[model samples]
Target: MHGTIERLDDSALASARDRAWSIPLDEFDPGDPELFRTDSFWPYFDRLRKEAPVHYCRDSVFGPYWSVTRYNDIMDIETNHAVFSSAASLGGITIRDTPPDFRRESFIAMDQPRHSAQRKTVAPMFTPTHLDQLAINIRKRSAECLDNLPKGEVFDWVDKVSIELTTQMLAVLFDFPWEDRRKLTRWSDIATTLPGPDGLVATEDARQAELMECAAYFKRLWDERINEAPKSDLLSMMAHAEATRDMDPRNFLGNLVLLIVGGNDTTRNTLSGSIYALSRHPDQCRKLLENPGLIDSFVPEVIRWQTPLAHMRRTALEDIEFRGRQIRKGDKVVMWYVSGNRDDEVIDHPYDFIIDRARPRTHLSFGFGIHRCVGIRLAELQLKIIWEEILKRFDNIEVAGEPKRVYSSFVKGYETLPVRIAG
Candidate 1:
């Protein structure tokens, strides 16, 4: 029975892929985990944009969904919040279907009134004045990290730099204990992990246990903050905010997970991706080395090129006709930002990682509409400062081995990227 079940599962997956391939490009399913893991999703997306800007996958590991592949179509869908909902109850913003019993509600997963209220509470953190204050510390940290790198010794850039720097930034944002900062990365990984050897949890049961521990730790912080005076840190801000203060235990844990993952993955992945991209395109790196003034333009281009979060899911709130496609109420609709960034109609030389593009911020990596990445400025700032520090310290940061990519369709990121610096 066990062997039969295993073979049946394999056959079903093979059948699914075969069907996906055999169908018209417009009907192709882009949700396969293997495509993203192998970094071969570009051609599939290229075909989707050229053939079917608005596509649909009748079935996937997640479920039936519509994919808006073109740049304009994605912006249209993202901006039309009235037609499409991001409510947690409907299925929060990822292709992964939120289980009925395991509902985790956060501001990013909410729509309209509540999302506005909750988001307003945290918006101040990214303000120009606030970010300016944060910049000093970010540069200091970036310099220290780069200075400490082992010269000429190959190391996992993902661990040594990407994870370390982002994790440190997260710890400061939450005013979390510096010693326990790495826990933030672990929880972030667990929250987004798929069930497998690469996943943090082996089963749903294990995931729940780890998440509970995450909640318990944060609950203690919540307890401490609630009793104290309102402060500038995220924990205090959320604890005092009218919209989020009275949140249920699950919602509190949900929002905490949301913030951690938001703050961790996007920036970390881009930092790793930037190095890998630059290594592959030496001319671009050389151009940047010649002109450090291009860091502002270079950072956004990397965000576009890397597209850390590949897709964002939305549930249709009402029946609507989008580009001749019939989308019914409660149906899943995904905005494939990864595909849109590469849309040649919008971006010139979309495949190449050019640092000095005339319009660098035109991409949808940070997304469109009110639900755009709240920490986008901070993400950009960190990347810019880190690269500035990197160039000051090293002549060339060479890729030492093939990168080990994360096994997920959602978080387009690296697990390990080996590197050695030349001065």
Candidate 2:
């Protein structure tokens, strides 16, 4: 039965790719308000899934490429990491143009034995067993953040709570001075902001400048810690690993920047979007409020509705036939998780945000295979706790003004969510 299902999926994707795809190659405007209506991208993805799951277009500003959107089709490419790889030294994990400084930097851009080695050093700490130790603290912090929210007043949820809370946790992880944690957050914002969308903004320079400054600051902190022993934070762990077992400083910076995103933006977006989702769906909100036990399921549903990291790009390491479309060895292929998470075949209903939805956690906002997000559990825990606390503290919470979305196709999330909360 499973084998037949798999074959049918493959055949459907192949047929789709052979058909003329609907996505225009001309300059893509992600900012179009029409896009916001389809931001979850259901209609377009459904069309693309039927028309061309791995179809190509010639006019994309980052140059021509195929969009790999269906769940199984994306799974085939992502799971076969050796063929469609992130280790491409040129463009790195993304197909967009790479910064000159990053052409040969970071473990994320490294392949094979080296990638395994660097990934191993930090992977142990992120395991569920280790994360279990930190859950209590995360819950405590989340409660404190929510418990202190200004009652009956409107505030930007993204700025006032989500970003602030996540950055504080990141500071705890990095063992940095919590007071200046916003610097790390700013560097991450800039890092991911670069090669902006279609690689059009020329903001990569500014992003690199901020990253270098942050890296230098980290190096200085490492020196200071060496002069006077520091605590057991992620930075200290990386520093020790670097000194005892060879590790590149640039890789540390790259991963540190990556960690910030893993730890901050996704969680922030989830929290911010959770508030918006709750405000919009009063029934689900009431359900969560009435039966907080469902908060666990609600976390995953929020991710499904507000998928934090919308998409991740990969470059073909070798000529490959993805759903019948020939992806040349140097070709760029994007995995639209934004589309895949909403894939009708993989998900039931695909549109409803049921708080008690059976297994709402099945979606993959986190990448699959070798590069799957290590902090997935932590992010989930943070969201669940925040929801629990909000439900307890505020009887009613709502959007008081227009919500603004972050202007990035890759990390499509909320930038401002105004709300009035009452006890």
Candidate 3:
């Protein structure tokens, strides 16, 4: 039995390798949105899960890194703060060339005492009550933004609904000038993301130039907001941190850049992604429309389906064995949330789009441990309220064209989703 099983296993492995090689890596460009729309990723990710849960890939532009593809393993490494630290020296979340000070500026890069302190100062702002308050404003803004939807005429949902609504809400959170909120969104996009496939921002020099421009824009926003008295907004809270909390210029700007990026991009993609999923499954859409109450639970389903922030990289402080693999000290490990969401161990029917999928929060979209998304509740709130408002006004919403995703591996999102208001 053992010999027979060994032969069977060898055969299965051979078959998978043969299939994997059929699609060349050159065919998939990490920075191109077109790649996301292809079948290449789902199969590749599935293969990673089956073959190497903890595997290494050297093909990426950012260089070689280990991919952590299991649900339990990803969580173990994520919450195991002692073994896996978020230090800038170990490399920040994204696998990229970050300026020395750049990694030090954000909480995502901090570990231990510093992470706790910075996160605590910012946590109260996203409390249940605070988010509840923000929900009303977000709903109003979403309504107004969606109100302009011309019947039957197709338009890009990413620009009009997803990106626009989130940007506007971030502006409100920071209490920044309404007219320039889009600037914040643009800066956040630039601060993250490698160059696009058409060789745009391909070199570090170009990326650095963009980062400087991003920092300069935020600095102006900070100079203007820093003087204002503390208000209920996030900026006011962050401003007060200087005296009552622990933060400096570098960290402040870093966190500020992070907040705008986090609050803007992930939600934007998921929102656009939700529409894309519904467009594919009109049955699911009708179920949602028929049982509007499903929206409450469906929001999590939307997030799980999208898995916006595809994967985050964690640097091992020291050598540690994980999921049958020896991860060396200072090795870059990627926690592929997209793969984890489909983990058969934790999630049932991993491939199905079950809107009423109970315990949808069990998904790793927000990640696990202390470093989980600080704006998680806020993100869900935005999606829920936006959909709630959308369902209230429009009877039928459909995707009118192919949805374009972003070129960055860090933020897996749609660039354009032409949608129509159903009659």
TM-score of each candidate? 0.93, 0.86, 0.88
- Candidate 1's residue-wise lDDT over 333-398, tens digit each? 999999999999999989888999999999999888999989999999999999989888776777
The numbered model that scores best in lDDT is 1
- Lowest-sum lDDT 10-residue window in model 2: 1-10
Highest TM-score among the candidates is held by which one?
1
lDDT of 3 at 327: 87
Q: Residue by residue across 1-423, what tens digits does model 2's lDDT show?
A: 000011124565455434324446243322232343324344556667766666675665456667777878777777877887676464766536565566534555566667666666666567777687777778888888877788777788788888888988888787788789999778767766634454324566766777788888888887776566644566666666643234566666767777777888888888887777776667777787778899888888988788887677777888877666678887877777877887888888776778888778778788777677877887887777677677677766767765666656667667677777764
Q: Model 3, 65-114: lDDT tens per residue? A: 78888899898889888788777656787756466645545777788776
Better of 1 and 3 by lDDT: 1
Q: By TM-score, how accurate is candidate 1?
A: 0.93
Q: Which regions of candidate 2 deviate over 4 angstroms?
A: 1-42, 194-202, 226-231, 242-245
lDDT of 1: 0.87
lDDT, candidate 3, equals 0.74
Q: Which stretches of candidate 1 lie over 4 Å from their true place?
A: 1-23
Error of 2 at 170 (Å): 0.4
The 10-residue segment of model 3 with minimum total lDDT is 1-10
